[model samples]
Target: MGLNIGTITDACQWECVNTGTITDAYQWEFVNTGTITDAYQWEFVNTGTITDACQWEFVNTGHDL
Candidate 1:
């Protein structure tokens, strides 16, 4: 089946990145738009609080988490 865009929200404090790790604080409080996993913690939106166009280019490519 085709997977659609999904959203994610971490209960604990976390920062979304392209990959995940023990050192990677589990604070990925983000809206998972697709196949996001524990290894994908380096794809966080580091654009600060300036919500606007081009603010969603923080995927860091298809790199491993």
Candidate 2:
């Protein structure tokens, strides 16, 4: 799966679980917390106060062909 964000503000929490890719291109401000859990690959781009606390977890169960 894939995801993108142009602007995120005052977000209390965010969670992402994917087997493909994720991207955030633009601005994230005043975000309280966030989490990303991927099995393959992901990307985060752009700037601004993303969050006060952010967590990322990656788990590889197998190989990608």
Candidate 3:
């Protein structure tokens, strides 16, 4: 139903190649270092935090949030 991520360390790296839908509900934070590559639809509800040090590359051609 939802995803709850308490904290993300500085060493954390994420590579997401989504072709469908990625949905997250509630609060979360993406901090320090990371990479997010979204291709299709990505949806997020509620509030969240993203630090300036985190790298996000979204190649979304469709609907995204």
Highest lDDT, which number? 1
Higher-scoring candidate on TM-score, 1 or 2: 1
Query: Comparing 1 and 3 by lDDT, which wins?
Result: 1
How many steric clashes between backbone atoms does each model show? Answer: 19, 0, 0
lDDT of 1 by residue, 1-65 (tens): 01113322332233233333323223333444444445433444434433321332344345444
Total colliding residue pairs, candidate 3:
0
**Sliding window of 10 residues with minimal summed lDDT for model 1:** 1-10
Q: What does candidate 2's lDDT look like per residue over 1-65, in tens digits?
A: 22423222222343433332333322322221345343233233323332322343222324431
Query: Over the full model, what C-alpha lDDT does candidate 3 score relative to the true structure?
Result: 0.30
Consecutive 10-residue window with the lowest summed lDDT within model 3: 1-10
lDDT of each: 0.35, 0.31, 0.30
Candidate 2, residue 12: how far the Cα is off, in Å: 3.5
- As for lDDT, the candidate ahead, 1 or 2, is 1
TM-score of 3: 0.20
Q: For model 3, state the Cα shift of residue 45 in Å.
A: 9.8
Ranking by TM-score: 1, 2, 3
